[model samples]
Target: MPSTPEVNFFQEYWIDAWQRSILTLDVLRERGNAYVERSARTAPHVLSFAFEVVRDGRTLPRPVNYALVRIVPPQGTAIDSAKPPFVVVDPRAGHGPGIGGMKQESEVGVAVAAGHACYFIGFLSQPVPGQTIEDVCAAEAAFIEEVAGRHREAQGKPVIVANCQAGWQIMMMAAIRPDIVGPILLAGSPLSYWAGVRGRNPMRYLGGMLGGTWLTALAGDMGNGTFDGANLVANFESLNPANTYWEKPYQLYSKVDTEASRFLDFETWWGHPVLLNAGEMQWIADNLFVGNKLTSGEIRTSSGVRVDLRNIRSPIIVLCSWGDNITPPQQALGWITDLYGHEDEIVANGQTIVYTLHQTIGHLGIFVSGKIASREHAEFASCMEMIDLVPPGLYEAVIEEVNEGTERPDLVHGKYLMTLEARTLDNIRALGVNSDEDNQRFATVARVSEINQGLYRTIVQPAVQASASDRSAEMLREFHPNRLRFASFSDQNPLMGPVKGLAEQVRANRQPVSPDNPLLSLERAASAWISTCWEGYRQVRDAATEAIFLGTYGSPLLQSMVGLGTHHAPTERRVARDLIREADEAQLRIQLQQRFEVGGLPQAVLRALVYVRMVQRSVDERSFAMLQAIRDMQPLNDRMSLPELKACLKEQFLLLRLDEERAVRAIPRLLPESEAARRAGFEALLEMLGARGALPDEAARRLARVESLFGMNAQPAKVAHA
Candidate 1:
């Protein structure tokens, strides 16, 4: 005897629930089919571009599991051969290759659209029989050399984009062979592994908690000499249980029709895990992770050349996100503290390090998010020339959208302008969560790792090796939780056989809930509740893990047992030899003392500009681009290469640092003695400084000094819009 309204409501709820169930089934069926199809492909590189294999690592003397491919842009998007080639090296941390270019709006896509010859460094799913990380690094260097050779007409060296794990490898390569790399962009990569804040960045503590690199060795051996990547993917999923277990599925269910494609696309990469060799895995864990040797300048290749960050002379652009838990901004940027004493050390070493921190993008989003690719990646690619032209210093590159009413809107074709602001070591430290106690704990972990690794090698490894066989390893890999989940829902499962047919019927007679439907709202509420539960559990578990780690490792008795003292010592900064060489020092002093009065008008203008930049300690993309434009237009055009220009700028900077008053007064003498020439030079300098419409008080004052020195009329510093 229910009322008519109640009966109607019950009927609507039932219909809505039934339709949602049908759509969920259909989505699952599609996912299963995509998984099966992806599995069958075997050598699946999920890239959108048509590519040719340029360099096969297998052909090298020491074979590796990687290859270099040249991407052929689609018709009507002809590449400018004269433009520097762009090479992207995808990370092989856990997933298969090509995530960087799977979509139209991606790293590779942005580079190709900008008319650069594009290349990709991707690896096979299975590692070659005896490949090592060093072999892979060597193979990558060879690939870069080939690309550089092919692009001889380009203005500079080939630009490289290294994502995640690949970022560290690229840095190592640049350190070993600076001649092979131009401007390097490291996205979502961890350079300083031992760097992180307390209670956050739990992954950094896992190695110490687990008793160190022995566990990594055991896992590799358990995989039959090849480490399975599914475990790594599982670890990543575990970091965000709410999204992995609940929100992801609920999102697809809510918008099953529209979200299916994106879900499948991402899962295709996430589900398809790759493999790493035992040696490669162990090397990464021991040297890079546990030893923390790369930033310390202690990692040496098999050929005996020590890989040092200071050896990398190429300009580096580090793009990290504050929201990334896998590699937090601290881990991404803390190497500056470990490697350099101050910003002056960076300049003396002749390195340009530009970092951009996104407020909320996660680790994966740094490389795959379309919005990020369109804005950050596009701006970085467009500004490579200007970035190279920037003097050696630390900078933070800021990307902002162009205002329609802004000056020189025509020059702003990409809807965004990137500005480089000078930064100090204090700024880098602000981005980090560095504590001396944490460093000591990590150092203790490193020492413990060596002891445990030795014990395992002598006692456990032989037994493990004797018992482990290819068959058993294959069985272990097949039964992994990540793999089994996919397998269970795939065509291999008998219960899924009828899903395709039923899904087709559901699609044909599809019905969806209205946004205002009470049932739909309730479903969303339930889903959110479930997600919250998972998140709560994850937080508690992470807290327990962290507490246990600190309690066990923080104990003084354990530290004493490991021969570690509790005293915290500051990390020593190693300066490059070239920075302090006698020849360079003598030559710099000579240039500084040589009367600047003998230089030409162009030289004087450039010197004055550098002086202003040094004093203000800031330069933006608009200003840098205007300077380049001006340099190209006059008697300065084709007069000096970028290196020569950079050299001149550095010399002037050093001279200004030595004697500011003398440097400022010498500007007029460097300019033509003619009053008209001095006036024109002053006007041009003002135009460059005022390109963005307003100047800071320091810049305005500096300009006044220059006008007075040149005997020009005191005029307000302003310029017409381009």
Candidate 2:
């Protein structure tokens, strides 16, 4: 090892180098200003960029404009029919479709490279007058129906990818029409709205800090009908003052020559904020963001049917990132904890849920980063089959690297394979820095929201709505601070014409600073230091806000005044079964019998072995071995001669409630000469006799007589052990 002094000398040298690399405050400010000007100039072109068009073969009664953007292939070549279909639903929060697939290496592009048929769910620039969320959902359903029809010629259902605002919306559509969805993937979406850890997940604190969403209502009314998208973008930017003030600008200045185009492209979308109708924004705030009614199983369609997530039969894949302060993994995964409370509940409900958490990817990166797209999204698209094969359960998606020499796909999109590990909701809860006490704070927020909304409607909404008009709305959109930047940069300004010429000249001779340059290094150091300081300031401000809010409003007296005294019921105890093991064994047997009737011996045995492995310690490997042995029998080939054996196995599985089709399928797995076949048949017969749910004694005897043909004797030791 090197001597301590030598190591210290190197460290000291690097520190000095870093100090020398810092950029002057003036230089940083200038760099940031240039980026803003450039971005503003390019805003229109970026916002107006069109998604490559695609035609759906399955048409609807009314024309639902559909597009197919070849995000990776660049729009001319045909896609392979064998690849799975990936459909990206852009958030309708304010902006439209394509954000999820804006770049060539975006979510859609990643799926296309992985051999998936890519589809974009893009809407018209204008929303239909009086259109409700239900109408939008119906349109989505029609789109899914069309996609599914086209995919009937291929294999597997289409994977629907929903981002941010679209996540909950797509989930709502899936909850109502599960048959249309294969596996649902949600990114940067928060389903458990009221769920957050104290002093963290500040976005959740936004609703409370704003004193409720009446300002949103007022804005919508003032705009005549629509809520400006600039407000939404402003809210997002407000999360980090350092980024809004210095860091983002400094980053552009540090790499101005190379990064200007990229910065302009993103700013185009960022500046081209869209609008949402008054009723739409109101509904979202009341039912989702603040009300927290959707996940509570309280949200219902206008037609009266309840929207329960458990009603969705399709697999759900939740992708969240730790670095996404906007929608933390806690917010993304907390719904599972809130909804089911445990893994057993999920399994019992026959739902397969898989969640993957990226340690460092930010919110936008979950949908926009090519690296994330190639690895995380690609693995998910490639492994739908493997995931489907995973029997109904709750699992954490674990990614692992494979050797380059292995028989992996050539040019694998990702460097790793997606694997599933059984997980309980408690496991998810542990990842969150939340307590039940923290959730109590949300109850207070919700109560305050209701009162504020009521107060606004009663005291202020009438006047706000009465004075609004379409012209005013347009003017409002034009003058908004977020939009003003773009407007001021446009060709409409006389100064912009000169600035544009200068920008072009700068582009020609821009002597971009090198990453290795000492000055560039110093700029980065300074930016980091500033960001750290800003973060500390933000933390203290938030702490003080939270302290004040809790001190006065969190008290029982104020909680009562705010109508927040509706006591939370004590959490119910988990049911503890008497003879739990025996019951589980019996249940397993019946489930197997049902599967034997429906699928076959191989499937039935495989399922039983799964449960056997799950319930019994040290039995997993053995049960899996048995499953393989059963699969290798090729019982289908000798079904005619092994009818008796087949009947026996069928009966045993029926006792387990495995499904009738499985029993019939298993008929072929038991060969005439196999000794194990006879024993398997015998056990199946006993299961059938015991599983007759409501048969009379005489009827039971008759069934038992039929089962006796295969000897309904259980190995006494096995029954006792069970």
Candidate 3:
């Protein structure tokens, strides 16, 4: 063998050579073409572009015409009636709705496996003309109504899953029509719009840096009314130049022979941009992205009704990733920070909010990655009832693996069971310092965005609108810098086909780099060198950007523009003492002992159990189902209304006795006179049922018997006969 120094030098030389060759324009052309052809082939397998248009009486514009796709359950499968239906509303930010139910390994898929009836809220390539955000919300309400009608045969409310942009939209709908939806899971979404820390999230700075929403407006006018989706894709790519430029390409080139198809499929969606109406895009930037009004209780519908966060009473599960620079955990959890300001306020408001933060997963990974979808989303679907059982409060989801007779951490296909902790706002804040300065900075951005938007509409919009046409808009969409790269080289181009064929053949017989390969070793070293330089550059760039933004917009004059100097005056609304009186007259009480007993244990003993176990608050559906199962026990046969029967079963739940005397101790609490007091006590029993959660069909049927007894228009003769 050659001397060690000589061998090392030769390896380094070849690696440098390979890097230079790979970085050339020639290599990029061949690779880009290969990517497109492979994407053309694989796109069909991964994506189901087939969709049905949803029209609700209005003459919607062509651009807003959308398609609703139904996710069918498995063949020969029996669905559990207790499982709720899941409808995932995909982000219309750029790509279409299939993402929510793209494959058997997605959010929709996980829900289906857990026996949820899955449906997807997706739109077409062209939106209907004059389709405002309001129109879309109305359409969603109609869809829910249709789904509810279909599911009336089986009794369960639909659980809505909103991803990214869809999260806010679903929230707006849920706030307006809470009766239509059950529990809501807001995944990888940012609701408190103006929430983020400095340096960490630079994406929030893009609006101010680009001179606010004017550029979008100008683009919209140029599009004749529609905003091209390519712009959004470009914005996502620009976040990491190295990843966009070299790393993504090199990863494929290094594994080119194998990764060619996988790389292409992703890029096609990444490349195939969508469009939105001018009115819709502009509103998003102003109200959601910049104004940050939704979480603060300042957002309003076009009809002037205020959009209040507190009005949303459903259990909202917020899933976010710490590694997602786009919507950080801070942005995801910030709504809680903005709305309540304290944990007690959450409980007092009777809101149940649970959030989970993954240590390292990108924005897309939250939806696309199988590891995350199968484990996190699956676990969430499984524990939804348990989540519902959690008393109204703010809690941080904690997941840990169960170790059984082992010294090492147990891994089940690389997943672990999570133990959720009831947390205070201070615990969340301790994860990162949430200071007012950051809030102030975002406020300033919002103020500036408003000013800039006004100027654009007043000074520049008329000219652009007058000059714009449908043809010009189409031209702009095609020739957009982002689209140009893919369009010029796609299969549609005649010049690329032969070269693509030749490259496929080359790839067929091609050999790949291995640990023993000199070029492989050298390539790794070059990548490390490049990464270090990139990190340093990023740090410097961030520091400079912060300094510039603070100096320019952090001034007192601009701060006031953001409504910071002026505190929000509390609206004068007298508390309805009558409402309190009604509940009191309705016979509501703060009974600690009853609460304990309803939860499947005695008050003192349960508290002692909690104090001693110190594991997790045991809230399971099993015991509640057991109590429902007792309805089948001999000789308490009666049919009643479901709500009332559920209440009665709960009243009798703790009455189960090892002996006659033990059962006797609980009899008085199980029965009461005075119809309203009886109803109120029954309500407590139902609360326990809800807390205990879920029942077997036989148990459910027995419970149904109890419901039939108390059901409306019951015969007096029946009560006398009993």
Candidate 4:
């Protein structure tokens, strides 16, 4: 009785489905086991690298749970001790640290492969009792100092990788102690709290809808002084109802053969819940999320010192994605607009700010995705020094994949080419900015939050604090849906005890159905329909949430009650200018003009390169790489170190900014006296200019200007290269 083809397909689909059900449960059991195992450890993290503890923030003068650890490179990989070290500061929003180094294709891996020393900042499962965000920031400052001290022979200070929440944390540290850090990479971090388009980015509207952070305070109190991290993780999941509620589990059943391990790996991190102090959560809620105070210069340290973002001299590189509902491009880049009214303001402050926007990627994917690790993070590592030496200005970091036919592929590193093109504040605004009414509504939300928090303290605090006990808080945390979901199916549970054996038997006799199976096709269609339904619901929910928030917050009566009436205009909160800084910059500009006749061939070449950049609109790493190669050919003693080059470039750029014509007119003064020296420099300029394929008309014309300045009529720089 052999079965027909139709019967065979039908039977295959059902058998695979039956096996997948058991296998998916087994995968869940593994995730639960991982969660249970991690819970027993002192400082459990998801870092993919093996590292040794270096310094503990808990041991510092101001104790916190954070600690610094050096990532041990994989076997046979050699790290150059002289190169700038990389320190990745993990975000403690919910999950444990080590996220940036969670796989071989990650920030830490790229840094190691690029021959740089690497370190990571990780926190423990529980926050230090009574620990404030200030304490954490100060402790991180100590960690940076410790890392810097350990790498004294390094070319530059440690480049800090500030992931998500750690981005603002590192920014505050750099503001207070700007000298210790090198360049900073702000990966998916949000500085602007209230920047979002209407009908989208509904997360920002939650505070207003809920009448402020009173619920945050309530959660803290209910935790008996220890806020559970699961709550934050739950909010992240709620953003994507389809993925979180349906698709995630369904995908396991549909592709259990290949997706099980990945599912378990991700769930291992996502399921691990940590704890934060009640006061710490409240501080973040008040100061960062709802208050929108970081870039506004409204935050002050415990010692009453103002934390101004402009005080941060280190280069800030912001990496954000448009698809990230949590930290959209607006929140990631809007801080620049909030802090600086014009592009010249950033330049005047002597700050280098670079941002890169991905077309699509979720918030976690910014650090967790393998493609991001290999491309965006890789390009940043390859050109760390190049970015470090760029002049103080706002620029956009553009990374292009190196196609097979890419021009000047020799100049590129790995699979991508990195470039920094000058940009303006208008570029950021084009990403999607909130209107005046939107900002007004957010302001009213902040005011309403204050009012509600006051009322909560007066009315709700006594009852919650009195009834909450340490034992009950522990039980409450254990029962959180995030934890219960895992624990309920864990190996510890008697009901799931047979899943492991059944999954093993299924794997030993696997019978995956063909992709062409009709029943399987119908199943996929059903799944797609369910996902579509969930997506529709999410859109409607977000729309309703936005409408309610706007209607309530935009109400004149409510606004007046909260003290945000029509009299108050809606603009992003701005940092007040320091007149003293302005005067100092003015004097510096004068000093720069006087030094126009400084240095020899190197200075001449640098000025020419800056001229090329000024004239040509679109540029890439080809020219920058050529500059270093030309420098390398010079006498060992004559070659300037990276730090010295940074200083020179900054001077030349600022000088040109002050008066371009005057600066160009002064280039001849910096040229050498010897004919051979001048010729060598001129030839170097031609080489750098010709590094990219054939020079376009604008570039050729720009090179001709340099030629007139250099007094050379040698071979045309228009020489083309395939």
Candidate 5:
């Protein structure tokens, strides 16, 4: 054959490289084709799991494009209906819905495999006409209500896993109707938009760089009252041009054979852009991004109800990563410091805030990475029931892989076990936050945005609408660069029609070079060189952006012009203390003190758990497991549901907080006088707190004090079954 005639090492290298180039182009073609096919589907979600439609938001009182679907458990997986259902709300930031369940190993997958009834909140490609962000929030609440109604027999309300954009949306809904929602896991949700470090987080400076949300309103006007999501996706891509423009495509080119499937799968979702109403995007831009009003209590419902983050009654579990430049731990957690001056305020409001920080996962990895799903998310599923029953205060979630030293390995469901350690507001502050000056800079941006938006509505918006027609808007969206890049490479292009057949032929006679080939290594080095250059460019661009933003917005002239007289961010921007809530808190503390000694073994066990937790030595889920065992031993009707367990735990924790000395002294009174009954509980609880090595004196003294209080000796017994 012609190829056999030139069978040499150099020739092989040359042939392989050429073949790979074709294959890479072909892969892109396939990806483009997939985008087209997905767009044509009736319901084009990328969820690997099959699901049944529950309720359509289009049919709701306030119409929207969202739909709630119940995921069918995968084969060999059994769902327990009595357990609370897990509802995953997808983000509509840019791409189409289903990032949370795109793969088999995802949030929905974990919940389904764990035997929980799982539901997905997905949306149509287009928003319903005249729908606003408020309408979407209302629709979500109705969906949650429907989910709750379906699971009336469940021991707990539905656990909501809100992803990215959905994180803030679901929080708004939960704040309004916490009764329908259960514990909420906000994965990669940026609640405090203005929270970031100076040199590191450059995205927050974008609003100022663009002169505020005027561009957002212009984009919507150009689209005939709808905003193309491709713009949002383009902004995300602009963050790392090296990865977006080169590394991602080169990855497919370098390993086209094995990576094609995965590349296409991801692009299937990322390539298909959705649409949002102009009003919807404007509200999000004004209130959340540039305005940073979500946590500031400035955003209210259409009916005049305040959608306060502090009003969310469910447990708020924040999952973010240090590597996530998009939604860093600061943005995810800064709201705590914004709302509460001290940790006691969180407790006073009956709020349980748990945050988990990952060391090196990117923003997408927080949901899409299989490793994260297997570890952090898996652990959350295992501990969510316990999470519901934990005290109302701030806590840090620590998930450790099951090692040899891990106690009660049998109790752990998967490869990891999760522990919730009590944390203070200062701990959250330790993870760098915006200073007063930084806050003013952002507040300046918000003010300028308001002015710019008003000017556009007054001067330019009408003219833009007058000239823009539906046909022109559709044409503009069709030719959007993000969408065109993919569409231009598909079969619709006459030039790409032959790529399919040529690629098929190349596959038949494929000659992949050996891994150690010197020429291939040279090619890899060249690709890496190009990637580094792009990365350097991005750094320079980011630096310039930061310099321009800080210089422009930090001007005292601008501050005074914005009506910030003292050049200080208004104190009222921080959550103002509600006099009514302060009175309720005072009454709450008094109520907690009165319930010093609650009834029954469950109440006694909860009190002990809170007491050991206060010491913060090493009491963990093993103690929580023991609590479950005790519940199992109780009579059917006598056993508490999640709501009752939560009430008992909060009461016990508050009792300890109001008066620890009295609460501890009365522990014996709460427990049964029967020596065997109390001893079993003590042994079960103490087994978890005992140190493997020599215990610290403080921990040891607390241990001794607790043992004495429980009427047991210093030597802790083996963990006895309930």
Candidate 6:
């Protein structure tokens, strides 16, 4: 009794359903083949761009697993030798390298498109024998030096882009060898390991739940001398089981025709795991993860040099996301709290730290999303020069898109304007959910870690090492769950042989269901329900884990056993030594006095301008660009280098902070005696301040000071026309 159209629709739906089943099986076979092929390759970098090796670590006395490669740009894009070279260091956490340049719209790609030479630091699957993290650091430093030597005519030091784990390693390099590196960009890196909110971040309590670094050592011992990276990969997957187990596969299955290439491309890198030496694994767990000593300036190298973050003089740009549970904004920005008590201390230490927060991007999205690459990474690359020119202080780098038909045009080639606004320590602290009770709990964990590590080394380490063997280690790595999952479905399995032939036949007579089909809609709804069920399970599991962790670690008896009192005390703040503080202040005071009356018209004008900016606490690309234009004009042209000009600006700023009244009064002494020169300087300062919009309150005060020093009346001159 059904109509003709209804009968035809049912027939088409059945045919489409049969085709989709066959297609899904084929896609799976192809994915298995790709995995097997990738696993068989040696030294697989997985970079979308072609590269040539520049330096090999195997040539060194204490060789590492890494190598430096120069990227070969595609057609229509050529490297400019005059621009600063960019070096991207991908995280070697659990996967092989090249995530930074895995796609066309990535960090390395953006840098290359901007006409800069690109380089990538990657490693092999196996680490060199007896190679420690310190050795790896040294190798990276040597590689950077080699890159610098090749580009002697470049404008500045090499700009380093480090992601996640590489972020902390690069910071350590910058602290030890600040002279070789330029501005460093840290994306999704957690410098402060113990920082997190109570209910939101469950990973922070992982160490406390396991009792200490003993479990890490036990895992390493079981692996015979190298830790299996598959285990680390499994731990990361456990954080988002819904995505790992349900949504990821279901999405691929629903759109198998379109999603095959993307899925395989990502899986190639995800499936290939690497290894870490036992010593390197143990050091990271003890010193950085459980011990929490890097920011506190307690970590030391083999050569007896203290690894203090204050030693790094390069400008640091921290890029994090609110949705990144792995490395939240608190973990990314909490190092400021650990190093300095107040914002003034950062300025006094001569550090320039700029941070930007993405609203809802996830951890991997921060580095791999093409949309993020074209916007945030593009804006960052365009503003590196201006970032270096900013005065020593804490700032928040704000990037906003340019609206259509707006008078305020894009400063760079992109549609975004990057602004650096001064911020205080309070602003940084507001990014975290800081609780005194939480701090004491983490401090208690640190003490327990020390005691446990000592006990393990004395009693447990010897027996484990004596029992471990190379054959058993290889067997353990081979049988890891992550590896077995891939191997189980690959072409090596005899059962998959018929799947390939059936998939080929389905592709030859393909029939895809219409997106609006009723059956297809029902299928998608069913998939969604499955995903939701997995998510609910994950939430319940996480809540129970957190409750258990707090109950076991927060016990009074356990606290006392670890030498912590029944009522735990907050950790003591670390401050700079008095001798260093006094010495730095003395040097700054001497420079301020010496340069108080130095220079002619140009120098006087710049000194006044810098003082105004210091008071207003706002600096952006538009203002700095205007300043550059003014610098290119007569009298200031070719007079001083950028370094010298930056030095002058810093001296004036320090002088203003030391004594504002005296510094403002001395402005006239540096200016020319002629009234015409004084008026012209005042007009230039006003122009720079009003470039963006209306003057802020501090800028108004500064404008009044400038007018008073020039002996102008209460009614200011018409500088807007100038």
Best by TM-score: 4
Candidate 2 residues lying further than 4 Å off, grouped into runs, are 1-78, 404-414, 504-526, 566-601, 604-722
TM-score of each model, in listed order: 0.93, 0.75, 0.76, 0.97, 0.95, 0.93
Query: In candidate 3, where is summed lDDT lowest over 10 consecutive residues?
Result: 713-722
**Model 1 misplaced stretches (Cα beyond 4 Å):** 1-3, 567-599, 635-643, 672-680, 708-722
Question: Residues 562-675, candidate 2, lDDT per residue (tens digit)?
Answer: 665547542221222325434665686555544443544333333332322232211111122222234345465753222233233334423333443343334444323454
Candidate 1: count of backbone clashes, pairs at least 3 residues apart or interchain: 0
Q: Candidate 3 — which residues are off by over 4 angstroms?
A: 1-64, 153-155, 405-418, 560-668, 671-722
Model 3 lDDT, residue 193, Cα: 56
Better of 2 and 4 by TM-score: 4
Model 1 pairs whose backbones collide: none
Determine the C-alpha RMSD for candidate 1 after optimal superposition of all C-alphas. Answer: 2.9
Q: How well is each residue in 398-506 modelled by candidate 4, as lDDT tens digits?
A: 8877897787889877778887888988999998888888788888888889989999999999999999999999999999999999888888999998898899999
The superposed Cα distance between candidate 1 and the true structure at residue 688, in angstroms, equals 1.6
- Give the lowest summed-lDDT range of ten residues in model 1: 570-579
Candidate 4 segments exceeding 4 Å error: 1-7, 713-722
Comparison by TM-score, 2 against 6, better one: 6
Clashes of each: 0, 41, 23, 0, 0, 0
Candidate 5, residues 31-103, lDDT tens digits: the string is 8888788778766888888889999999998899999998988888988887899999899988888888988
lDDT of 5: 0.84
For model 6, residues 508-572, the per-residue Cα lDDT tens digits are: 88878777777777878888898899888988888887788777766678768777665556565
**Per-residue alpha-carbon lDDT of candidate 1 for residues 506-537, written as tens digits (9 for 90 to 100):** 78877665677676678778988899899899
Better model by lDDT, 4 or 6?
4
Deviation in angstroms for 546 in model 6? 1.9
| Model 5 residue 521 CA deviation in Å | 1.8
